[model samples]
Target: MAETAALAVTPAGVATRRTVTGMLHSWDLSTGVDGPGTRFVAFLAGCPLRCLYCHNPDTRYLRDGGRTPAEEIVREAAKYTGFIHASGGGATVSGGEPLLQPLFTAELLHRFKHELGLHTALDTSGFLGGRATDALLADTDLVLLDIKSWDRALYRHLTGRELAPTLAFARRLADLGKEVWVRFVLVPHLTDAAENIEGVAAFTASLGNVARVDVLPFHKLGAAKWRALGLDFTLADTPAPTADQTAAARAVFAAHGLQTV
Candidate 1:
């Protein structure tokens, strides 16, 4: 369980010794595709994986963004409570990887759930899912789990990480009956392999808590970011998956009795 901490904001506006603080990237007051309804999304900074198609490459570094108190973030979100609640919406903590700052994430979720009475969600790659504590999951209402690829080799090539940990986390979430929405990226010749899609769809279908699936079409939307960062944009020439291709990928999930969009 997370214990309450005594704290005060420092002269620099950083909250000191009060619970935990995370590098704050930015916030979106309203978003539809992140979770269920309209959501107040907090994009934290930092990630463990070097994903090739990452749009916000700037967030790859820990503390690249200003260090902010979770309390401050929740207090800000409290302002939108009325609109969010009325719309059957709530707050989501997304990130380069929220679990990378597990304590901050847990404290933020706990505060919002108890103090502001918000329906909290976590959007993660599940790479650092092992960092999540029971208290964290207890406060989370839903999980937007991103399973980038199914095949281990492809997964490694895509995100510079293994697939086992992600799968383990997903299985754990399912075992706990936590509501989850699975997200997958469809990249031509990379992740769009028929066998890969089938493997992912089948695995997700086997999970009891997955309520929906999102087959995201790959795009070069982030190529500029990669270029700006002086990082090689390997997928710079990769085109977005066609509608027919996306539909075909969805069909794989549908065959496994899962609804995808």
Candidate 2:
């Protein structure tokens, strides 16, 4: 019985436990949600922002994703180590706002790294950069930093928050040499203005540490999610960004010598 109990730990501490709250979604351990390439991703619960174009309306509320324990998630992910390794992918903790649940986010990433030997990435708006602890930074391998808009007014209008902190976070992360993929959603006239895109590209260029830039064309895929949540869809009539618009915007960043994905 003692030997049986000892055997249960497995290579990744399978018997050890950790706490988690809300839904933990996983996919090909190498591809990322942002594009193709298998990746094991956990969409955590809760967020502080109220973006007008948010598609993950189901993740906005802290309680919406439901409660889940961390150990169970780690154990389940452990089962796919071979898949993760084979696909040249790792694990990513994304969210309504993964930063909102930093403790859980850090803990999960640490387990994946130290226990499971997995490459880990964090997808966040960096809205809570200062609020995040050093411990969290120490364990994160990469960051997907989303800059909603260049203009503060437009930022507040779109995300219901200020833009300074996000920029500050970007700078700090760069200073620390953290690999970051800057994410900008092309939201038609809202975030697609030439001046706004210029400013955003300038900011990203200034960082000098950006690994790549991702121009995500805005879509209404999450509109139904907002409706389901009984929330007013402010951009309900806003048309999605066109391919030409996205390509044009991508050109702006390319002009700065930044690689686009």
Candidate 3:
């Protein structure tokens, strides 16, 4: 595949030439990953979390995606500005992990807001932290935070990482009064337990800024990506979550008055 054109902006109002690497393209009128409405999604390269059910394994590499300058992405996505605004949509910077590229995402969001007056959203796993995270959130308009598993043990098991930091980060985001859309993958026999769901619901309710909750049914879409990369797929035998399973989990949040869908 050919690389995307370069678009770079320096701090002093200078635009530099560069090339975009590992850039993937998508132009669909479907609902945002969080909900309904057309969105121009930019799937950033790399991720720190390794959720067992992650479907975008290709996105986990640190630098697999080409170095598409922030300006280039903003420019390309700008084409859909009209439709995005009219439909109450905007650019969503998702990732292997968008938080990993805070500077780039910030630039994109800043440009989209200041230049195009477009809404901006970040779909994050709530993992990355410290100064980088703070900078990214500073410019983000809305956040789609994925609370993988409520139980600390299960969270570590699912993503091979600690959960406390992510939970704390969520609280911090809430304290900042940022609009948050909490999402959880309904993984049957793993993450959809009644207790876990309730625990997540309670935690989110405590935050008070979680505008909505989403129950994304577990799928194997990332299995292929794993295979292509010559890695063993762990969830090969795992089946996708059924509608009833997802509905039941969604009900847990709704029952807690969490406005889940």
Candidate 4:
């Protein structure tokens, strides 16, 4: 669990400060991918799933990250607010599953939305979606939801977790009328099956709030990280989907009447 500093109290026994902290992997600025324009992306550490193609395998454990206060992260983002806003970008609280540290994630989202005055996005696998509170979702403007596979068995094999939770979460998000961008990574010989892609496309299209679908091609960018962590990169030889294959997958979503990217 991420550590939280004890609340400071005044002489009258009134609480003055309460610092919500969590394990933070790192943060960076990115455009076109993370969200909107240019985003100040906070990559919180600790995830519930063990995805086979995770590029940031080093962020799998909380111990691998530094304990960071929510205020500190907000302050850092505040610095780039001008640039971020100018670029039509915002702040994204991503993970090792930000929902793992719900309180900290909430604080950051609230501050980013109210204090920093920026669009907020939550990039999550949605496996821990139940952990997210309504208030947390209220502060979020967009959700970058990853629905890795449509096949339950394939999803389990790929992420070491069931796909039901993610599906349920997607439904919940849809019911709430929240804006969402569905992300699907197309892995050759794994998630590239037509049926698998169709399953994802059909579900995403059925969600009224889904704005677009991102058919990301699987890549081995994190293979070296896995090697450095002394863990086997299982998909080391699994080739990335070809352009034609990726386009075909996007066509599936487009056929379902979803805006595909």
Candidate 5:
């Protein structure tokens, strides 16, 4: 466990004092998938959703993670500063759902941007978007928001949560002019309905701040994790979207004049 009593700056550039700590699942380096260029992604613990195709079920609970100080994470990310900068990469605070711990998430974003001089991003389900303070959003260069489903009922069925919050958050981000990358999982016989995809695409396009849309194909990569966790992997038999299916989904977003990847 790590802890830090460091002064952090607000979006206004005013200094504030606080003791910041967070439950960390782990950290890794990745490119393209996370954000522009390469990135050092911190996978925080805990989440508010149980998406059927979640790849990291181990991060579902806060207690399952290690307590680490904000400074500790900053230090670790600093080690990659040169590489990240050279590659035009940055740092991303991701999670089971980052907004589940807004304060800790805010602190990390602040340090990643101000302290490490890295572009900062927040990857969240947007279910807890209300928790993210404006100051926090101010520090985030981009938001990787997951909009699980456009149909309300399917959303509830898929994530065991309502979709209203995510939509509301999207609207708010648009109002704030926040840069966003909307991510949707395309599952065969599940979220593959054209109307469902269109709903998401249309709504995302309506949000002027959205930079792009990611039509991720749903897969059973996390089935083994669910089995290990003694939880049912309902999507085990679900097939990944074929290349044509994926392209069609991307075309939906493209039709809305939004970039897809």
Candidate 6:
């Protein structure tokens, strides 16, 4: 499978605001996995990594979609503030990679946190984590950080990008005492190596601010997306990790004295 060409930033249909307007893709009213509770997920367009397992292949490009204003998005998400707050969930700015568009993502997060008083979370690969500003981290209440693979070489092979940027971002988040939930996808032969998992467990455990560790079992649910995009689904032959594998991973993290989910 070949990687995507280069990034292309689209500006058409963008909605302007006090700061910088954003080029948005779509939004979901509520869901459970994006954050703590029922989250109103805003799937922003544009990302730097080409992960083989990305479900939202459509969002990889920075093409224009339903480009709504950040304030407008916050207003729409605010409608469900009561329900989300009652359930302890809030709004999440997810992406291809939110950090790819640092200004717009930060603006959206800031409004969701201060204007609507909602708990804000950013679901990201952390590949573009260096783009994150201090203000953005401050507005974000939680980070659903995807640490793809522990081995630097494996990380590049798995995500088609360097691993140092993500590690730097994780260190910065920990230094700021930002709450984080480290997400690791368990693949069959490619990434389920015991040593690699141990490496990830060790690194995440070292971050004292990590509130939870979510060991995700790999799945081919995104094969259809790849087909639709005419892009290669590299993990089409990969099997999802079994329950026992997942349990064992959880045990590994638990042994490191880190909470697991």
TM-score of each: 0.92, 0.88, 0.86, 0.97, 0.93, 0.91
lDDT of each: 0.86, 0.80, 0.77, 0.93, 0.90, 0.84
- Cα TM-score of candidate 5: 0.93
Q: Compared with the true structure, what per-residue lDDT tens digits does model 3 show for residues 115-200?
A: 77767787887788543466567767888888988999999999989998788889888889999999898887899888998999
Candidate with more favorable, higher TM-score: 1 or 2? 1
Error of 6 at 12 (Å): 28
RMSD of 5: 4.1
**Candidate number with the higher lDDT (3 or 4):** 4
Stronger candidate by lDDT (4 vs 6): 4
Residues 168-219 of candidate 1: C-alpha lDDT, one tens digit per residue: 9999898889999999989898999888988999899999789999999987
Residue 103 in model 6: lDDT: 79
Clashing pairs in 2: 22-66, 28-39, 29-38, 29-39, 30-37, 30-38, 30-39, 31-37, 31-38, 31-39
lDDT of 4: 0.93
Per-residue error (Å), model 1, residue 209: 0.9
Using lDDT, rank the candidates from best to worst: 4, 5, 1, 6, 2, 3
lDDT of 6: 0.84
- Candidate 2: segments with Cα more than 4 A from true spot: 1-30, 34-36
- Candidate 2, RMSD to the unseen true structure: 5.7
Q: How big is the positional error of residue 165 in model 4, measured in Å on the Cα after superposition?
A: 0.4
lDDT of 2 at 221: 91
Q: What is the C-alpha RMSD of each candidate to the true structure, in Å?
A: 4.1, 5.7, 4.2, 1.2, 4.1, 6.0
Q: Point out where model 3 deviates above 4 Å.
A: 1-30, 34-36, 132-135
lDDT of 4 by residue, 1-261 (tens): 685756878899999768788899999999999879999999999999999999998988888789998889999999999999999999999978888888889889999999999999999999999999999999999999999999999999999999999999999999999999999999999999889998998889888999999899999988999999999998998898889999999999999999989
Of the pair 1 and 5, which is ahead by TM-score? 5
